[model samples]
Structure formats: structure tokens, C-alpha cells
Target: MKWLLACIAPVLLAAWILFLSAHGPASWVLLPGILIGIACAAGLSFLRSFSPALRALSLTLYLLPLGLLSTYRASAFSVSKDFELGALPLASAPSEMSIAQLPTGVTYRSAAFGYRGGSLFEPRVFSMTAILIKHPKGDLLIDAGFGRDIAQHLATLPLPFQLLTRYTLNKTAREQLQSSGYDLTRLRAIILTHSHWDHISGAADFPEVPVWIPPAERSFVQGEDVTTATARSIKSLHIEEYRFDARPYLGFAESHDVYGDGAVVIVPAPGHTPGSVIVFVTLADHKRYAFIGDLAWQLEGVTEQEERPLTQRIADFEPRLVREHLAHMAAISARYPELTLVVAHDPRSFASIPKWP
Candidate 1:
């Protein structure tokens, strides 16, 4: 019983706290439920001690279903396609432009956490990428990789898995930009799709560049400790609230035009997070790319249409809402064939693009 409590209590407590924090639920209601649950769990484990095999079976029954529930709930927003379709015509690789890739860092993770059928025997290795847009006006960084300080801070967070196992911040965005001959201070602006730590950790590096963030993201950041601080600290940053606009590249959607040109546009793509926006860039050559942050964490999410496993999905009190949004994103992507979608964490997409530095 003690061993069971030691194992299950921490996981449940962490999950519960994260749940409460994500949703502003009344703590009074949750506290008693958690306590009762813990008691019931411990009591049941004590009773099953007489049969070790039964205890193990009970544990598996309890956890496996919970994992499935979490995964389905987390993917409630994910879109399901009944038939397999070939790649769209516009989705073809660009023929005119040169592409480069910069490795931000390597994320380490258990095989169970990565691909759709990742097994303990098949360990998964992944890397984070930042694709640089070498524009005529200036260089635009798609996803800002972590700075030195923020990377170290994340290394110490009380997460079940090491961030380094999932992401590596090998080259800071600022350093890469500078080394590539682009002045850090002269950067035009940064468009962020969401406020996940991995996406926004480099915000501190470019203090003065105007950051264009989706309206919903601004609200989401208020609930997170580190990100809220980073959001508040970004100097000269511009919060682009959700607005109905009629622009050339943006068409009619909730979006913000950074330079009022068709060059860079921030469009709301809110399933990954409340305020998640897709940074759409039309290169000088007229090729378009959409940087969808965490909308799809892995390339297989796009190619194979595999939703994240239940154990790894975010639990924001009401898991159904999050799942529904993810499904919506998949549906939208399926409908749009004109834009090349870029998932922020997918190293393959990043590798296919040009690196800034």
C-alpha cells in the first residue's frame, strides 16, 4: 500500500494540480474529491495485496483505461479522415527557393512518448528546428528556440520527463541570427503562434523586437508563471488581439498583418492553445508557409493523422474542449491545400526550410 501510494499519489496530485491550474475551477470542490479518491485507491490496493497478480491486473485496468480516456479527451479536437488521400498539388515542394535548417536543440523522450506506435524497445529521437526566412527587408525566425538562461530554467522544472529528452536548445536563435550576419537589434518583428515554453523561451533574447501574438495567446499566458513573466518582459512587443480583417494573404479571418504587407501575417489557429496563431509568411519568391506551433507536435501527426497518445495529452480540467480544438485544426488543414503547414516542433519540416544563421 505504501509503495502504491508513493507511486500513484504523486502522479495523481500533479495531474490534479495541473488540471486546476489550467482551468480556474474552485479548489474547494476538487480538494475533497482528490482526498476521497486517494483514500479509495489506497484502500483497494491494500485489499488486493493478498494476490500480487490481481493487484497488478487491477493497476493495469485502472491505468490503461485512464490513459485511453486522456488520449481521446486530449484529441477531442482532432479531425478523423475516413479515407487516405494523396498530397495536394499546392502542397508540393517549392522549386525555386533554396532551403536551409538550423538545429535549435535535441529533445530526449521515451519511445512511448514519440511516434504513434513507439515502444519501449524502439526509443524515439527528435530535434527542435527554427526555420529562418531570408527576406529582402530582413530575416524572420519562424520559431524562436530557447535562450541559454531559459533553457537551463526548463531543465529544472518538475516535469515527469526531461525536456532535454524532448527538446534541445543547441543554438540560441539570437546567436544563430547574429552569426548569419543579421543584426539582432534590427529584427523587424516576431510572430508567435502560441505560448508554450518551448516556443516562447527565446522571447527574452529579443527584448525590443515587436512580437505579434494572437489575442487568445495573451490570455493563455496569464495562467502560466514563466511565460507570463516573459510576455510581460518583452520590450516593444505588440499584442495582436483577434480581429476580423480583410487582407490580401489573410483573406477574411481573425488575423494581424505585421507590416501591412503580404510578407508576414499572423492568423488565429487556436486548437493547440486558446490564443494559438499561425504565422503565415509569403517569401519574396511568392511561396507561402504556415508556422503552426504545436498544432501538430510530430510530422506523423500530419502525414499519418495520428493523434497524440492519451498519456501525453494536455489535461486542462475539461479535456474534451482541448481534444475538439485539435480535431478542428486537423480538419482545417485538410481543407486548405494552398498553404504549406509547419508544425513548430517537427524537425523534418524545419530541416526542409532555410536556416537563418
Candidate 2:
């Protein structure tokens, strides 16, 4: 029994940390839980050096936290229930309001890393794709994926993150646009979902083009946050900070209607980052899409309402806020089945959009 408890304590503690990392209100809350879990596991192991009765009682106490963590991890969010979002907003999308996807690169990850209650054995391909939204006013590029300096950008990340992340680069957004003879003048601004390194890496390639971002995200880029370290490293980025008006749209409290045509609307969905946003684009065919940047890594996060597991602590500025927005987006998805929720990394989510030449 002593030997059994000694070997299992460390294993159970590791599992507990992974299972409960993002379950608390803030990311900081995870540290206490981890420290306590480690202490408890160590205490149990130490107890095993004494009487058999004491060892049994300590083992029981240690198992309690792991059991609790397992139960919490398995629990579902409120996204399971139906939500009312009233009628879809009226949109007068121009016939020329077109959209296409630029396949930049891909990163491989386990399904379990993306969300709670996912299969550990299943490998998922996460696309580093950029979106091109063309309008008569000016075309907008959303989330520049995989730049020429991707290697350098990646190196800026922590060593552990670099070791875990395995990616393949296909084409940078700039190369695709230039190769296709796309007129640079028509491209007005590059609107970012957030200023994360992966999403903003290709922005450096388009030095002349202004990168449109919300005020919050702009601060994130300029601030001393370690997460935005890569973004700050890029010297050529021209940021145009935009603000949201008091107008409400589709359950969101604030919205910025670009082009004043209701064809392109942006809403603050901060959780992934202080400046993270969801872009709603309505094409001429009346087809609508919501580009939810890193809100959930996969379609299942919206369809099934599963939040990120341990990655939320590293990926999200506020995990609780992320969960809240995920629930909201899930509700929105349930109300409008036709609306395409394009998750940033989920390659399958970009199926509807035509590929760039």
C-alpha cells in the first residue's frame, strides 16, 4: 500500500493540475490549487513513511481533490440550453462584398488540448489561415497568418511552448496576395481579431497597410505584457485604434459598423485578450459569418459549447471571461444555424469561404 500510494500521488497531482487549471475565476487561482495539490500529494507520500492507518487516511484526503476536479472538468456550460437572440439584423451587403480564405500554415495539436472532455489520442490540425473580406469601399484582411519571420516570432515564445508547438508554413498572406496579382491599393486595412503573435505575425509583411484594432488590443500590443512580446518585436506595424459605439447588435452591447452598410460589423468579445473581437460579415448573397478569433479553437466549442481546458491559462487573458463569451457565442449559434462561426485555428470552420488564388 505504501509503494502504491507513493507512485500514484505524483501522477494524480499532475492530472489534477491539468484538469483544474482554468476552472477557477482567474488564471492566478490555478497556482494556489496546484501548490496545495502538490503539498497534499507530498504529505500523503510522507505519511506512508509512518503507520499504515495514517497512510490510508491521508490517501483518502488526497483523492478527494482529484475526484472533485474530475467532476468539474466533466460538467457542461450553460451553452447546452437554447438562447433567444431576436431577429437577424437587416443588412444591405453590396454585390461586390466578397470574401476568401488565405491558407498560410497549420499547427498540430491533440484534441484534448483544445477543449474539455476531448479525446487525448485524436490529433487535430489547426489552420493559420487569413481571411480577405473584399468590399467596394476597401478590402479588409482579418488575422494575418504565418509571416516570413515566423521562425523568429516563434522563438520569442517560452521554450516549453516552442517545444510543444509543431507547425507547417504553406504561404504567407503577403505572398498569396502578391502572387495572385491582388492590388495593394484596394486593401484598406488589416483588421486583427486580437494582437496575439500567431494572428499578427503576418502583419509585418504588409508594412504600408494600417492594422485596424480596438483600443484595448492596441494597449495590449503597447503594454508590457509578456504574451504580446512577439507583437511588440515587429517594428513596422501601423496601428489604427477604433472604438465601438453604444449601438447594440445581436445581443452584443456595443458594436462598430464598418462602411455604415451593416455588411461588416465588429463587436467586443474580449476574453481571449483584452482587445479580442468578433467580426460579423454579411455577403451580397445574404450569407453571414462571425469570425470569432480564438474564442474557441474548434467548431465543437460553439456547437457543443465546450470551453478550453488547460490552454486557457496560457492562451486567454481571462479564462472566466472567455467562458462567458463562449456561452454567449454558443447561444448565438443555436439561434442562427445559418451563421458560420469561423474559429481562428479550426481549419474545418473555413470550409464555406473560397480559397485564394
Candidate 3:
């Protein structure tokens, strides 16, 4: 144990410094990667009973980014077979108002102001998009895009935060909604799949509307879970009590039909966040779309069966859960080839999708 601690001190220190610089001293999100670093440092100082040769080998861990990438690519997370679940319970009644009933199977209005992130050579566009769902009863928005004054707000954050995850927006959701002449009052609620910074940042614009959050996600902001703690940047949470019934779709065994209309179902696939969800929108045209929230930044990640490297602590909390979720998504995609798997941040899919009126 002493040798192991000594060996990886470089990795831990590097991770700790980076996390501290990005999040600052007071951020509780620092618990995961930073705690081990402090513990290891204390161990080295107090114990000092390890071989120098083992330490050298562990210090080389950072030098081998290829090895790190390979380990991430070699996903070893397994789903629990013992966990039994049933298919979604029978709908109380057929949904009277489904996408099929709409003019062209629901109008999906996406206020997308995307940015090209990652590397300059292989930059992938990530859409900071807010989707407005129009139903007869009321209007609902999913995942608020960058809100008004986003630039000013971001400018207030740390320099490392801005540089590491550089966000460039073309338009804010509030700007888009206003320019499009959409009525804000009609927006009865905002459905948040998780409480990640990007997902909830723009929610500040909808103070009047109730924000629907899953049970686990509600606890995340309340600082209950250390492993998956969300930065309490946004507040005024109005959690909606919805039931997640047992149901199977492409082998996934639990889902909640939000409106009791089998068409729009919320599948709980927690990994990116404790309460992350996959929103399924099945239209009458036989086109089924799964709006997977940060399950992967792009659909290719699922189709290729890969995840982002471990060094990324800003978005993901559990690598094991992410690996298992990706495997399930891959299984579903392979089993049902016709269905379109939409990634929340994939700019390609966002650009191609039609807008609602």
C-alpha cells in the first residue's frame, strides 16, 4: 500500500492541483479526485517506508497518456445481472395527445448556440441547446441553453475554468425564444435530466416556471451525495414528483411515461449524473428518437462503444456507471438500427433537427 501510494503521487498531485485551480478551494466537488491526493501525500510524509524504484514507475503514469486512454477504452464495467426489473407498466390509457397527433409528429424547437470544443485539429461542436416541447396541455422546455448574459457570467469564473472548457455561444435560449416570438408564460415547466452546470445554467431565465428534477438529482444540489455532488450555482428548484415505473425498451428495464402516453418516456440511465435520463420521443411516422443526456457527448461514442478519458472530472462522476450505460445504449442501437440516438451536446444532430413553431 505504501509503495502504491508513492508510485502514483505525481498523478494524484497533478489531478489535485488541476481540480483546485478549476473549482477553487471551497468547492465540495473537489472531494473525489482531491481526497485521495491529500491522503496519499499524508501517507508519504508519515510512513516513508516504500521502495524508490516503485515510486518512479508510478510517476511515469502521466507520461503515458496513451496507456491512460487505452485503459479508458478498455471499459471493464459490468451491469448487475441480479437486478431484476419489469417492462414499463401498462399505460392507464392510450395517450390522447401524442406526437403523432401533431402536424408533423411534434415540433421540436431547439435554441441551439453551439461551440467547437476539444482540440483545434479534431474539434467537435457541442450544442448548448434548449429544447421546447409543445403539448396541448402546456409547454415544456428541456435542458436550458446558455441564458442571457451568459458571457458576462462566465467571465466572472476562474481563468482555468474558461480555458479548460471553453464555451462559445451563438445565441442564448432567452434570446432565441424572444426572437422567435415564443410565449414564455406558456412554458409551464422545465425538465432537467440532471443538474450539471451546462444543463442547468440557462435555467436561471425560467424563475417563474417550475424545474422538474429527479429524486437523486434533487439530492445532488442539496449536497447529500459526495460522489456525485453538483455545484450549487443555480437555485430555486421546484422538484416534480414523478414515478419511475418498471419497463423494458431495447433491454433497459425501467422508464417513466411522463404523460402516461407511451410516446414520451423518461428512461433513468444514471452515470453522468446521479439522476441522468434518456428522453424517448416516438412519433407516428415510426421514427423513434432518444435524447440521451450526456450519456455520451456524441452518438458516435455509443455506436463506437467508448467513453471520455478519466481525467475529465467536470462532467462525469462514475466511470463504471458510464461504461455500463454506454454498453446498454450500444446494445439498444445495435438491436434497433432505425432509431435515432440523439446526444444532448452533439452539434451535428442539433443542426440537422427541425425546429418547432
RMSD (CA, Å), each prediction: 9.2, 6.6, 9.9
Tens digits of per-residue lDDT for model 2, 1-357? 555555456555655444333221235445765675676566665774767776666666566555534532545675343444668988999997899999899887756667776664456788899999999999999999999999999898777667667788888999999998999889899999998889999999999999999989988888987789899999999989899999888888899999999999999999989999999999888999999999998777777778776576778899887887888887788788899999998988999999986
Show where candidate 1 strays beyond 4 Å.
Answer: 1-101, 115-121, 136-139, 159-167, 224-252, 311-338
Q: Comparing candidate 1 with candidate 3, which one achieves the higher TM-score?
A: 3
Give me the displacement of residue 158 in model 1, in angstroms: 3.5
Could you tally the backbone clashes for each prediction?
26, 0, 4
Better of 2 and 3 by TM-score: 2
State the weakest 10-residue window (summed lDDT) of model 2: 17-26
Ranking by TM-score: 2, 3, 1
Instruction: Estimate, for each residue in 1-357, the C-alpha lDDT of model 1 and write its tens digit.
Output: 555563455456545433432222443546755694775477455754546775665565456335533443322224453322233222222333233455667654433343344332333445556556554455556556676566454654445433223344587777776777866655565556665556666756777765656556777765654434455544434554545364323331345665455556666656556666667666545566667666555655555555445333441323343344445445546666555677665666654465544
Predicted candidate 3 versus true structure: per-residue lDDT over 102-133, tens digit per residue = 01111111111111122212334456677776
Rank by lDDT, highest first.
Answer: 2, 3, 1
Residue 127, model 2: Cα distance from true site in angstroms: 0.8
Clash list (residue pairs), candidate 2: none
- Candidate 2's TM-score: 0.83
